[model samples]
Target: MKSGDAARLMGWDTTRLSRILRGTYRVSADDVRTFCGKLGVDDPAGVEEVARVAEEPIGEGWWAAYASRIGQNYLDFIELEAEAQTLRIQHPVIVPGLLQSPGYVREMITRAPTAVSPAHAEMLVSIRLARQAVLSTATKLHALVPESALHAKFESGPAIMRDQIRKLLDASQMTNVELQLLPLTAHPTYGSIGAITVLSYKHPWANVASVDNALGGNHIDDPQQVSFLEKEFAAIAEIALPVDKSREVLDEYLEGLRK
Candidate 1:
């Protein structure tokens, strides 16, 4: 049977089916049994065992510890980031979270629309630092940041902003990272709308997209939405500076800060 037909028979959307197959989505024992029955699996005993296992609760991931401190939406995004094989991120006004420096994180948190305490702010900074671990792994990260982000003034002043730019320069040199600067001279098609991230997993149909807002953000798993964001990322990359040129932009900005 065709995969599309199988998905339809199970009454599952492509995104949900992909998540379930990837073991990221929860499934009930009845649902597991129905899937096995639909597939005509001969081993009733095996199906029962599989259903039993499905009934067990999934264990909490490391990020679960931060549930009370952060919103559920942000936690969900972190999990997605942890599992993504490649991330395409475009930020119009600020550095991407995974690429943000501790000082930048603290400044952004301080200026957040919803105020947070010092302790909570520190936790958020630690979370951003921890998220950077994926850059050291095989996961590929491509960031398209506008040149204006480097020039944006922060209340904390030049020193922190300088540190932020330096962090971008350092991240640009990583083997698994690609950094592009969207120059002021070149206009982006849709990048200025908001910060968006397209995360693609090892599974062919498991791609997702997210748009960051003042609040946490929305995780979009619809195939059509994800595809549009993917294409938008490609278009933005076309208008952005090349990796070497992007690094040069960072260098110039950092030099300006030093002066």
Candidate 2:
């Protein structure tokens, strides 16, 4: 049908329909239902799917405060993260964002390759720390960090790492979080894989994975690719120390930091 016809049927101005078609309009769920009804799209499931995805409030989200200063990739991850039923993350180089202490976050953001103003760095730090709120929610986090990461050098004094380890220890005790440490002696293959995060949703939405690199991060939405990362995380978890043992290892690292 022509744009004019479709617009008339959907009770929308031609310009409005055109903008929606061009993906420039933020069409609401009610608007979608009207469109589907007028277009004879009786499939409730299809209509609901499109409507559900269309109304996600990305522009009006709390993270919108930092949207201009931060990368869209990071924003996308957090949006999905807030709704994820579970998050499986593997970090071999540094502490995962959700578990990092404020000091660690500050140091990491400041040391990042893409330099930002001091105020901007603080904004980033706040965002990361805020992300940790997911841990206290219905969302469960399964994090895999190599033991070496606990001992990784920080430009800041040992105090930074000490506080970080302390934070990790506290997080490990959370009922909704599982923190595992891959021993240095683990299989080379497990230790070699780079950082990855797989967010699993309740329904309708498929799994999504994010791989970290020098260029901030990259999201993998392909079902097959997400499956591969999920399998890889399982294998790594198989080799990582159990939660109780992981806490013991963290304790050892914290003690060493004191020395």
Candidates' TM-scores? Answer: 0.78, 0.81
Model 1 C-alpha lDDT per residue in residues 13-119, reported as the tens digit of each score: 77888888799998899998898889897877777767876886553667878877788899889988987899999988778888998888888876788878878
Question: 117 in model 1: Cα distance from truth in Å?
Answer: 2.1
lDDT of 2 by residue, 1-259 (tens): 8889999986689998888888898898988888888888868887898888788765776777877887888888878888789999998778888999888898899988887898888888899888888888989999998787776677778889889999999999999999999988887788466898999875566899998876568889899999999899999999899999999888988778423
Q: Report the alpha-carbon TM-score of model 1 versus the true structure.
A: 0.78
State the TM-score for model 2: 0.81
Off by over 4 Å in 1: 1-57, 257-259
Look at candidate 2 and give me any clashing residue pairs: none
RMSD of each candidate relative to the true structure: 6.4, 3.9
The number of clashing residue pairs in model 2 is 0
Candidate number achieving the greatest lDDT relative to the actual structure: 2
